[model samples]
Target: MAKTFKYAWLSKLSASSSALLFHYFPLRNLGYAAREFAKQGLKPGELAIISKEAVAPYERPALSKAYLFPESPARLPGFHVCVGSGGERLLPEWYNEKGIELILSTEIVKADLAAKSLTSAGGETFSYQILLIATGSTVIRLSDFGVEGADAKNIFYLREVDDADKLYEAIKAKKNGKAVVVGGGYIGLELSAVLRLNNLDVTMVYPEPWCMPRLFTSGIAAFYEGYYAKKGVNIIKGTVAVGFTANSDGEVKEVKLKDGRVLEADIVVVGVGGRPQTALFKGQVEEEKGGIKTDASFKTSVPNVYAVGDVATFPLKLYNELRRVEHVDHSRKSAEQAAKAIKAAEEGKTVEEYDYLPYFYSRSFELSWQFYGDNVGDTVLFGDSSPESSKPKFGSYWIKDGKVVGAFLESGTPEENQAIAKVARVQPPVQDVDQLASEGLSFASKI
Candidate 1:
């Protein structure tokens, strides 16, 4: 069960100079960071995690995946922090035992970084000597675009547990109804599959020529589009939802497209994209690439303040550039890196700069794909990518300056995925593109 803590006791504990406050608790690595703090000699009541969420940090990605399962869906306490990454499930009791305060259901309305203080929406003020900003990102809403009937019920966007719960309830109520999923990115593909599994007629609409056009090549997208078609998913490309119509009860009923088409939708799931939640500290910190700029240690321009996860645009040592990644892997790793950096600085020591290898993956209805490294340069499609194959297995390689810069594989074994990752990192040279395509998985294996 989830636990709740009252802020009345916070007044007594806010005076410590060692106090470390986490602005939000959506990150799984927050638990790991807190543990690292305790291990580094921080005492009980010295660490506090403040979140607008009602519950402690859980696996946020599951909201669009397993949490929405029609049967045996994942729930709280079961999918808490660290569990998503095969680490310890840090339950609320664990925090209590560790003397870490979980300030749940609290929103920080004002942040005075210079004063090292945070003011909650409930008028509770908490002071901290060090701050870790993990506010993450907020989903881009249709209403933000002035779309009609954007406020209608049964229209959802998944980001937090509360959003997932609402979508799950809608899934049950609108059994066998039509679901129109907007956007063609990660959330769009995953949610569409889940909705279809729940017996809803799924139709995906995107403005791109193909799904996941940012990362997916035409050859790669063809397989998925074909597979989704076989699974009865309607793919409407090159258009977008211009507006939405609602029923008498204000539930979304129809989605009007820009290409002169209208789709009947009992439920609408919008996943266009998200913007980093950095407005709270806007102008107070250096900003770049739409995120708070930070050093290798995740330290912001201000002293004793750090930004991690989706909000931190830090140096990607691997690529020698400043970039911000919104994936869970980066979030988990960046948080831990910041914790270590903080502790090391406290001890007058230093930690190595973050060297990240970009990694991404997704799973749906027995289909899984993993990509590693940068997806730049020319591509080579390999193996049997045919959707109708009895056992479809295929991949692609991105060659930049005659060296493999990136690798993507579908339906790969654990060992195979690791091999591709190594290939991306090592970036082995290729003598010929056709030979590389023919080699496929073996090319990575030999590397």
Candidate 2:
């Protein structure tokens, strides 16, 4: 005998002894949280996942990475939940096997915290004993800033599957055409490289003096910017896209820069930033740092309700301050923590508090970099960081109060990367800056 899952729009439902998860964007954490529930003694039919996407929970980072590859692009079921973290690939069948109801493409229009009910746009209501909010973040759009002609065709923003599909179609339609990428953040750098790989004439524009200024120091940016330049990407820094011109077909034609330079474009991509999707729970939950504030357990102020992923502003035990991380790594960990806390509470047991070590990484054409811990304080560049190096291998360390507070590595081996991660977590003290630079990866390995 098999159990059938109920669709959200088909009928009203109640789960008096169950947990319900609501998520948008990436649901990798949601998948992990469900697994944790089952592993911690929750029975069949005790959990459900609600998402607006038609597909099951998958690795959202793939949308910008392998998904855009010109050859043999990544597809669903392959990059599904948990795969990004080297876990089992959780397909829709996995949910069925686990008796977890997957309510896909169901948008929850209203939420009643007191009633513990969520109403769908189709007029169906669902009630739950426990709620997990993992709504993630929404991409910031140029239209929000009143950028003229932002509504034109062939101007894309990659956030969801639908957006990626559209961009893929444009890539095929406008092969070997010119592309102007706006904003020099993660999407800007990655997309510029990807477009160039597809043989598109690519140009990157940013208002900052360097790309990825939020994390990359000038020295680190120099290597990447120079590499991009060598790859035939025109780097336009310290300027912004002010407006756009469209053809009669409503396709974007030209990008008007604030510096008074107009770039002819067959396609355009913007990656300014994203905002946490906490608007629905604004008055219902405690918020700090533009995200839903949670404890170390990822439990919100609301009883029996938890928040995770990009929407959560939890205590960074290392820094002793509340912080919101918009990366996939934190999202995955927070989701697991919330699930553990819920199950532990039921059994009158406890789990360890989350003490997260910040990690961020990016991958471009023949280049990959990983950063751990905070990027504040004085930085020391090490190794051959030159863009012209045949085999570029370099790293940087952020020293604060004579302790190695952060580490960034490029072209590092598995053991070397682990060493850097350990250094960041241990916060090893350094007596000589010159020695540390010269020693480079050796210093971290010895730590």
Best by TM-score: 2
Q: For model 2, how does the per-residue alpha-carbon lDDT over 92-125 read when each residue is reduced to its tens digit?
A: 8888888778877777677777877777767766
lDDT of 1 by residue, 1-447 (tens): 222221111111111112545545344647657666666776676777777777766878888899999999999989997887797888889878888877777777766778666776678777666788877788899999898888888889988888899999999999999999999999999999999889999999999999999899999999999999999999999998988899998899999999999999999999999888886787789999999899999999998888888888999988899999989889888878988898799889999989999999999888999999999999999999998987899999999999999999999999999999999999999999999988899999998
Model 1 earns a TM-score of 0.95
Stretches of candidate 2 above 4 Å error?
1-18
* Pairs with steric clashes in candidate 2: none
Tell me the alpha-carbon RMSD of every candidate.
Answer: 3.9, 3.5
For candidate 2, what is the TM-score?
Answer: 0.96
Assess the local accuracy of residue 159 in candidate 1 as a C-alpha lDDT between 0 and 100.
Answer: 82
lDDT of 1 at 238: 97
Q: How accurate is candidate 1 locally (lDDT)?
A: 0.83
